[model samples]
Target: MKFATQLIHGGPAVDPEYGSLCHPLYHSSTFAQQSMDHFGRFDYARSGNPTREALEEAIASLEGGSTGLAFASGMAAISSTFLLFSPGDHLVVCEDVYGGTFRALSTLFARWGLTVTFVDATDISAIGAAILPHTKAIYLETPSNPLIKITDLRQAAALAKRHGLLTIVDNTFMTPYLQRPLELGCDIVLHSGTKFLNGHSDVVCGFAVTADPEVGKRLQFIQNAFGAVLGPQDSWLVLRGLKTLKVRMEQSQSAAGQIVQWLESQQCVTKVYYPGLPSHPGFQVHREQASGAGAVLSFELESYILTKRLLEGVKLCAFAVSLGGVESILSYPARMSHASMPAEEREARGIKDTLVRLSVGLEDPADLMADLDRVLNG
Candidate 1:
């Protein structure tokens, strides 16, 4: 089957027991013992649930991986994946990473002795230079958060292999629909299903998928031990959201392209960041890897005063923290997403105070432009 078909029929779609179109939601805390000789495939809800298993299997298939594990939230998946490494192990990570991931590494993981070296991953050589003798893996985020920076996945994965290091990519921005890191020689792929994967913004979930069985086994153990598995209801919701992934992404991206063109034409906008733009730093590299530029873009104003006016004056788009919902969301990264980082560090990463990130929704391009135009000119 093709990619679009895979999204709907990727995993357990129909109820095997009743032939219902939707997968049945199994809410039991524990399963009954059929025989005393051995436990069934599902012994307890914490270890497994039919509904949750369906969602996990779907993500694994969508990501082209051998195994998939679900978690309560994006941070849970990230934290549990970090458990795969031991104390004293080193990792090389992208510089403009998600703040929650940064907090986990700089605070909790660092406290446990898991050292990390942050680099501008857009320059693949910077990542290579940061690799220490004990470096176990290289983590990356392409078309990175708020800033919309892109990292070349194939080159980064090859570099990791030469050093006998694992390549773990956070595939949240592109989703499996647009980019599959496992196909590019990466060992594992992670996602915050709260974003585009869930699409509706109602569910908070995460996934860890890997094509390697050994890595899959370790992550499965960590997920069960941590007991932060996504609940059955949220699992079903994500499953429902998966069916419409292609259409939603296409429409939102179309609107985003128009908005990018408008933002560039505006006199007040100082700079814009988007992979689809020809002038974008990694435009060609992104084209070679992912199928789309995605619906998110970032732009900077001449001053913080203009930034505040644009953010507070916007009518249609909600000035919010999260992205990837059907509704347009305008975010201030310096104060919203990257607030955890120190001032100097955020500035060094180029997450400026005047930067504004936008996640284009399914609204008409002209309507969104008018809303933004009214806000900017008013």
Candidate 2:
């Protein structure tokens, strides 16, 4: 089935017991057993739930993976994926990945005895050189957070395959509609359902889809052991969000292009990092892997003070941390998302104090442009 069709109707014909068209929230924490044997696949909510399972199946099918595991948050999904690696195992990761992922690897995971090497993923040689005998996985975030760096998933996946390393990707920005990393040879695909997948900024959730059954089993065990599974209402929200993903992404991407163009034309702006622009270094690599230049883009103002002024001055867009909401949102990565990383480390990754990232929503292009113009020109 096609992506759009599979999104709405892929998991089940309808809720089995209730015969409801929409997935019903199984609010109970425990289910009853008929014969003191297995209780029809779900015995506890922490282990599994019908609503979460339906959402998981939908994501798995949508991303063309063997199965999906839902989590409490994006960090939980990432941490659970990392749990597949043992203490002595090493990992190769993008330097400009999401802030929470970065913290998890550099701080928490490091404390737990796992070794990680951060490299510029766009440079194939850098990635190749960083690989060690202990390297068990490569964690990549294409169109990386704040910096908007694009990693060539096909090339990276080929390298991982040659080295017998697992490839895990954070597919939050592009969503399954634009990019399916697993189909491009990535072993596991992840999403922060709080963002574009939920589409409304009303929920925080995460999911991991895998082609390997062993990986799926390992993840399921960790999910159950750790108990970070998504709640029923959030699962329902994600299910509703998936239904309109194609339409919402199209609108968001269109508005983002207009915003990027406007940012490039402004005198106060120094540089714009967006895949849609010809000037973007990773434009070709991005186009080779994904369908559209996603809705998030970052630009640098001439001064840090000016950057602060613009963020505060923008009336229409919310000054916020998270992205992928239906309403326009703006963020200062230096302070908000990437704040956990030390200043020197963030600077090394090219996330400067003058940089501001925008998640373009479904707002009218003219209104967004006007609001931005007031900040850039006023």
Q: Give the candidate number with the greatest lDDT.
A: 1
Over 1-378, each residue of candidate 2 has an lDDT whose tens digit, in order, gives 777777767766785687898877778889888876555788889988988998899899888899898898998999988998888899999999898998998888999989999999999889999999989989999999989898999999999999999999999999989999999999999999899988999999998999998889988999999888899888888888889888899999999998898888999999999999988999999998999998999999999889889998999999998999999899999999999999999989999999999999999989999988887787
lDDT of each: 0.92, 0.91
Candidate no. 2 TM-score: 0.98
| Total clashes in model 2, counting residue pairs 3 or more apart in sequence or in different chains | 0
Query: Candidate 1 residues 136-218, lDDT tens each?
Result: 99999998987888899999999999999999999998998899999999998999999899999799999999989999998
Model 1 lDDT, full chain set: 0.92
Candidate 1 stretches with Cα past 4 Å from truth are none
* Stretches of candidate 2 exceeding 4 Å from the true structure: 16-19
